[model samples]
Target chain A: MLTYIVEDDPVAAYLAELMIRKEQFCSEVQSYVNGQRAFDSLKEANETGGALPDVILLDLNMPLMDGWDFLDAFDSLAIAKDVCVFVVTSSIRPDDIEKTTHYKHVRGFFSKPIDEKALKRMQHLLEVPNN
Target chain B: MRTPDYLQAELLDLAVADATLFNFLHGTVLDGLWYWDLQAPENGWVNSKLWLTLGHDAQHLPPEPNAWQAALLPADFATMQQVVAAKAADAACHTFSQVLRFHRLDGSEVWMDCRALLLRNEAGTATRLVGALLNITREVEKEAYAVEIANHYSTILSNQSVYIIKTDAAGNYTYVNDLFYERFGYDAQIIGTSSLNSIIEEDRPKCLDVVAQCFVEPEVPHQVILRKPYNNGPVKSNHWEFKGLVDEQGQVTEILCVGYDVTLLTENLQKSQHLLEVTKQQNLRLQNFAYIISHNIRSHSANLTSLAKLLDGNGNADQKAIFLQMLNTSTAKLAETIANLNDIVTINTQGAIAKEPRLLKEEIIKTLDALNVQIRQHQIRVEVDVPADLLVPVVPAYLDSILLNLLSNAVKYRATERPAFIRLYTYQEPGFIVLAVQDNGLGIDLNRNRNKVFGMYKTFHNNDDARGMGLFISKNQVEAMQGRIEIESQTDVGSTFKVFFSTNVDVDLYS
Candidate 1:
């Protein structure tokens, strides 16, 4: 399994990457500082016929294209395989939670600092087909 | 065959009997009768009816010209003489007539119409003047009452403050009272001209339709505003009401327009509407601010809780060290976010602050000096074109924060391909003094982020230090000093931020 973490804070991104690696939830793990970088990488992969990540953890607040903008841009792309997008944001705001329903690819909404219990749940979601 | 003495005696008797019959005829029907012999020394012979008309006994009245003149009012005596002179000058002028007032013994006056005819002798020379006098008191009284009513209405129309105008069936002004002319700055020359032409071009069609309706229904009134042409002066808005004036046959023959100036009232209403709009905008911003605050605080608390959960679980030394570092960083970020929120809350709750007149140039220079290191790092070319004494009302600390944030933003967001350039200037606009900060930098995409540009933690750029709190804090500070900030930007071109300070701010003594 391949996973992508899109977050602004380097510390948060590093922690999430370390947790994903420690749990061995995915065969490959990549981290980006903002939504724009992740979005560009995804677009480049699509153009080059490279393998796309199975799971993408998106953060709401970031410099240069935010998570919402990324979702808007990503929704327009034509891809054969479905990629599960989990909204991993520090915001517990009902509005942010409600916004996730707008994207069909978004699978779950999780709060910050992905603990052991959250990782287990995410791992379970990754194993489940079409979840 | 009779003797001369006997015939003379018979002639005297016949003359006395004729005189008795003539006096009786004159006394019965006529109020008075006068016979003036031009050749005689005495003025004339007047009957007892003359004394009766004067409200006096016949015994008391001396049948002399001087006595009759005393009974006539002094002003009428001269007019009576003129009548007699004119008649005497022209023999062909057979009749004389005049209406004169005569004073009575009871201290009251009676109006009389005297008519006289010139009686000529056989040689065609006038010898005696015979006239009849009739009392016309009741007729004169009725005529005087009619004049009083006419004068009363004329005074009311002329003195009334409201504009009053009358137009003919063709919509031409037939009459405009003094108040109408004075209010609209029109003159008598406007009469016989189309009154509808005075209405503004935009309102002309509607006014004409109303006038047409008035002609159809004479009982109903039509209303409209007529713009008064101002010669390089403030506009005067007036509200006018027009009604049809119908004749006895119920045909609309005229239009009466009455109106008053409503300029002040209209201005006040517009001012109130503007205030209402401003209040609504402020309320919406406050609601958005509350949401942002709760979202940010909750995000921070969630981060802390997750970090604590991770620490509680077992981990390797290397992993634990990394987690500790991340936890410290998260805590610091949370503190910084709280501090920014506190600052906004303080500004919002404090309301308007004390302001003083400070030179805009001085404030801009101070801001530039503080950001000198950043300016040098970016090699920005700064240009300031501001008047030396152009003062703006602001709180000193708020002015510094606003200028510093704007100047730093220009440098921070500058494009790397070209040398950054910043321009600061000050100018006066109606009701405000504006300080504009312009920059050639990485401009914002206003179409996508117009609503979120000044929102807390809303960053559009990829810069490492783009915390997105600068503009939010700056806006709050500006508002505290009774000022506002506006932005115009185009992607990759440039951005201009204009800060407006109210010109009517109350100055602080201790600047």
Candidate 2:
């Protein structure tokens, strides 16, 4: 399994990569601080016929391009539909939770301070996958 | 009382010769008498010289001469001839008086009172005529001067628009001007003899009482307010006021008043009060938003601090991994909130100018298309009904932000049990273009939280992923474009948000 991480904050991105690799959830885990760069890499991967990321961890508020922007762009790209996405944010506002139901590729929502329990839950959802 | 005729002539001749007897007769008589005949035109006789003052000759006049006709003013010539002719045919002693203008030898004019007595013969015909002429010009002039003064004052009172009322000490009007008739719809004939209290209805009793008070205390000038209903219309419920009236003796005899109608002013005051109330409500919402943002940010920062501490501890690989992941998520959220705050602050501090022309319908479609993935995933039906030709005066960026915010909201809050539906349309109302975005979503309780929905980080529902910043940003962007946003909603039903902007496509904002 492969995992892709899109977040503008460097510390947050590094920490997520370390956690995913240590948990043995993927064979290769890649990170991009901006959604545009990550989107570019995903487009390249689509042409190469390589194995796509099994799980994607997305952060919504970012500079230049954001998680929502990436989702909009990614929907147009002809990529594997089975990739699972999890929105981990500190925003506990009602509109954000309600908004997640709008995306068919979104697995679920997670609040900040994501402990081992939340990640293990994401692991299960990703393993089962959407077809 | 006639003596024999021969004795009367002898006595009159003897009397003319005696100065004492003539003076005695002249002193006692009210009339100055003279006699004239046709036999001797130059030998006419007057008893006294006082008669000569009224253009009469005392001597050398004809005995049977038409002296009255020669002495008559041109205006009285015809009437005098007819009177003399009628007197000549009768034996009766006839006496009559006429008022005529007498032109004196010096060319000065005097009004005269002329009286005549005719004496006739046995055939009942006049033998002689004697008359008296008295000057009465001074009396006529005095009477005319008094009438002229009264007429001048009445002319001023009737023509003036200001209320000029004259009342007695008991608050009864002796006179009121034509303005009183126009203002109260009262006939002048009816008002002349009527008391002022009769027209001062019960609703205006306070004004009447003030007038009464001014009269009782002769030094106080009355300040009475005449509050009449709004004039010339039935749809208005307003009153007008006029102040400052005083009577002679430095007291308020009658309340004179003049004022303009203030219906529009009163209405504008009420509208201003409503706007102030709305602004106060908005201020409360903004304060709450600041509090919520602080609380949410503090929570995230505290989580990050705790996770950092745990990662620093000598923990197992799994525990370290979990803490680090938590730290990363907390930092991202903190950064997002900071960015949202910056956007809100920018909107408030900077005065914005939207000088560009933006097509309102095109922007709506682009936003919907951008949200196409969400639209399809939720099985939503979005109807874009805005006319392609409709354009609004706006900045392109703000227009894009507003459209995106509204479209995303419609898709995000769709009812779970049913397919989502959104309707977008634009219509031209008077002086404005109205764009409406309506959705069948879990609508908010507008009565409870509409004021706070656009507040930063103020969320109504308990959903764990709500940031509560989208509507806030949208509101700012719309306002910066010199537009307004209104929301109509009910819980679990739907929400319709209407945006209003000037429809003028050629607005030159740079000017």
Candidate 3:
């Protein structure tokens, strides 16, 4: 499995990449500092026959572009990758949590500092058929 | 029995002379004259003045007693009969006088004073009656108008809600209307006593001045507020317009005061002002809360989460130790931010704080003592120019906290080249007491940071202790006590923070 981490903070992005590699949840782990860069890469891969990540971990707050903008652009693209999106944020505000329901590709909402149990749960969801 | 022709002509001349004398006397003194011969009622006699009084040609009037009666109003004719009957019942009353309404030949009525005298023969039997009529319409209309004017003024004085009072030239109450007694609870005992003494002591001098001015300039109105004390209720506030009542000779006769009670109006105005102030403070607190949640709380949480993720990863021993140290720092920072947020929330959402008159100098001195170490280390020169007895309405804790925050900020942001100097002073504004704290330190670029100066977690200086929460909390505390904070600063010159407290703070707003 291939996965992408889109986060504004370098430390959070690096830690997420390490966690994915250590758990062997994905064959390759890519990272982007902002949603704009990740969206550009995804667009290019969709046009070409390039490999697309099967899962994406998105952060809400970023400088150039944010997760909500990326979701809007990603939903517009006609890519057949069957990629699942999971929102990862430190904000426990009810408004942010309620916003996820507007996007259908979003599979789950996760709080910050994703633990081993959360990672196992993600893995279980990935193994499920038609997930 | 026929005498000579000359004798007959002489007799006729004598009769004509007598008739001419009678006509002359009747026309001069009365509007009309009439004679009724009982033996031949149709052969009555009337003078030309009767036609003139009736507004008709003399030729149009019939010389008959019934013709004269027909010209009178029916009611006046009945009244005339009663007067005649009363005169006849007492023969000693030879003349009958009645003011009766009479209809003219032109179809209009006239009020007339009619006097009739009965003529009796030698046998003392009444036979012919003669009368004189005079127009009295103008006199009757004048009497009616006087009565109508009197009734109109009496109604206004009795029914109106306005308090009317009349005082002698020496300020003694001469008369007070019903409304005055009802509104002020003053009895008849107040009469003949000085009414100026009823005003509150603080306002007595002004009331006396206004009264004296009115006396000097009669009919020129002056306004004053008087307090009327009660045995068991609150003092009533009466707003009065006073003017001197002047006589025709331009002498001041009395002081006329028209007033209405304004106690309820004043109380309602104060209540609405308090409600408006409370609403403004609540809106400001809500806005501050939104900012704290979005910036302060979220920033700290993000840092903690990022640090935790780093700790969960594998690394070299040296790198792991550095990560652990950063994680500890982040955790402590998060905890400190939460504590600061809690403090702010408490100050914002707390119930009404108790406010009392506190000495401004004492509060400043307390704050200075608490910051003595920092002041000495920095060699700061502090000047307190406030009076020792100057009282400001404030919450004690809020005053202490506000002073401490401003003084410490002055020390923390001192200029590097020069020693710090701080000045604290107090002054009076229109309705506020202002305590100003001025500093000679590294000032802020207000043009750039004006909006964010009092915002939570907004740091302008590059100091380790500049948490940026001090000013924000100080502002909240001051506002909680119905006060406000104003700032004036330049980039590198200095800054002055002025806090204002309302002068009259004993109004029971929260209570």
Candidate 4:
């Protein structure tokens, strides 16, 4: 299965890609620098019948087209693929978490450092027990 | 047959009918009557009560219409003659009435209501005249007394040095005098319109409350200061005293309001109140400020500490190098945040920031020189059109920082496909000198982010190099110098930033 990590911070995205590869969580991993690039790639992939990612790791604060706006644009697309979205925001603002995070395709909300809630959900989605 | 007893009795009753008829007219209305021989023209019989009513002795007066006509004013006598001649000329005119005033014996005047009937012969020529004179002096005095009282009250209300208005229970203007019309400069057409509409919107509820209170407790007067909009003038604050006038049933019928302009008196007080309110808002903002600072700085500091622990673990040279780099970035970001916070605190605490006069064009030149390297490297064009002699009083440091922030933003957000240009110009408005910075760059989508454009750390673009502190700080600095910042932006076109310097305020402060 292909996995995509859409984040703005280069270091964070690189770190997440390395960990996903080391863990052998999926066959392929793609990294996107921002939500707009991720959204555009998704739209092009859908139009061209390219491979769709099974899971998307989304970040909230990016320069252009933040995670919330991306979800809105994607939701309007009404893509038939049931790709799961997991929000990974650095800030723990409850008010921010309360909005746009309840999309039917959004599987879970998580803070930075890959917290237990995210890991548990990922394990469940991949059918792997945490070691 | 001609001498029956019943016939003799009927003839006697018929002979006394005129005397009884005259007696009934005199008894019921309690006035007197006169009989006149119009054919003879001098045989006029005057009743004793008519003379007695005027405090005159009937024995001394002659029985002629001219005798009573002599007591009437000349105009009234002429009116009497006209009425008499009209009936004599047209026999179809059977009756006439006139109100006549006569001189009493004691030199006081008495008013009389005189009514007359004319009798005619077969030839339709008037022969005899009969009339009644009623005493109506008391009624005329009562009517005149009422008018005098009304006139005195109206004079008092009109001349008062305050505005006087009367409204019905529903607060609609029933009466607005000349003074009220002139002071507010409203035409007479305002009568019957609502008084509440003239009051400013902000104080409508308060005005309604006071007016309602007066009506609820009619005996007690309510006083309040309300803002009323005047024609072609600044909204005036007026101190009004309202009193509810009640009908006999103790229910309020109307309200009377007296007020005077209190705008000058309350202006300074309202200013201080507004300052206090602003201070309270800033205090609340401090809480949000503290929250943001903790979130940003604490995350950076925590990341550095965690990286150092990881670097100490048995990692390879490559891993260690990455850890060191991450640690460096974390530490620098933390320091930058702290410096930004310091600048914010400085601006937030300014009471009256000291300002010095600087040439507008010269300052723009200095700022453009500082951004020359960026302008050259990006192939961005710069244009400055400020007046050479125009000088503005501002804090030099803030002006430099604001200019640098705006210029850097223009360069940082330039659309790659377009030839980027930044234009700086200045112009003088009525009470301000406005410095506008125009740029053809990646403009903000103001439709979605207008409210948050000046918000702290609100960045709308994909440039991660943006810490989102520049514009917020620029806004703070402009405000600290007793000026304001404004922006007009569109999504794909460009943005214009304007800073308004109040000429009136700055001159008043330093002069």
Candidate that scores best on DockQ: 1
Q: Give me the overall lDDT of model 2.
A: 0.67
Candidate 2 lDDT over residue span B31-53, tens digit each: 34556552343445554444456
By TM-score, the better pick of 3 and 4 is 4
**lDDT string, candidate 4, B1-511, tens digits:** 5669887888678658667745565745645566778777555776667678778775775555577656667788677667787878996888887788888888998888888888989999988878788889999999999999999988987875688899998888998877778777898788889999888888999989998898779967799998877765888888999999999999998999988888888987877887787778777768767766765675565466557666777878998898789878878777988998888987877666668888888888888888789899999988888889999888889888988898888888876788888998998888779999999888999866676677666788866567778899898888777678999998768999999876643523223
Best of the candidates, TM-score: 1
| Per-model DockQ against the true two-chain complex | 0.31, 0.03, 0.05, 0.16
Q: Least accurate stretch of 10 residues (summed lDDT) in model 3 chain A? A: A60-69
Q: At residue B19, what lDDT does model 3 achieve? A: 74
Tell me each candidate's i-RMS in Å: 2.5, 10.0, 6.6, 2.9
Best by lDDT: 1
- Candidate 1 regions off by >4 Å? A1-33, A44-61, A81-131, B1-148, B196-206, B215-218, B229-234, B244-253, B301-335, B348-354, B374-393, B411-451, B478-511
lDDT of 1 at B53: 84
True-structure Cα RMSD, model 4: 14.5
- What's the C-alpha lDDT at position A68 in model 4? 78
Superposed model 2: Cα runs more than 4 Å off: A1-131, B1-48, B51-73, B76-79, B82-93, B103-108, B164-179, B182-184, B188-219, B225-374, B381-405, B412-484, B488-511
Q: Which residue pairs overlap in candidate 1's backbone?
A: none
Model 3 local distance difference test score? 0.79
What TM-scores do the predictions have? 0.63, 0.44, 0.45, 0.58
**What's the distance in Å from true for residue B226, model 2?**
2.8
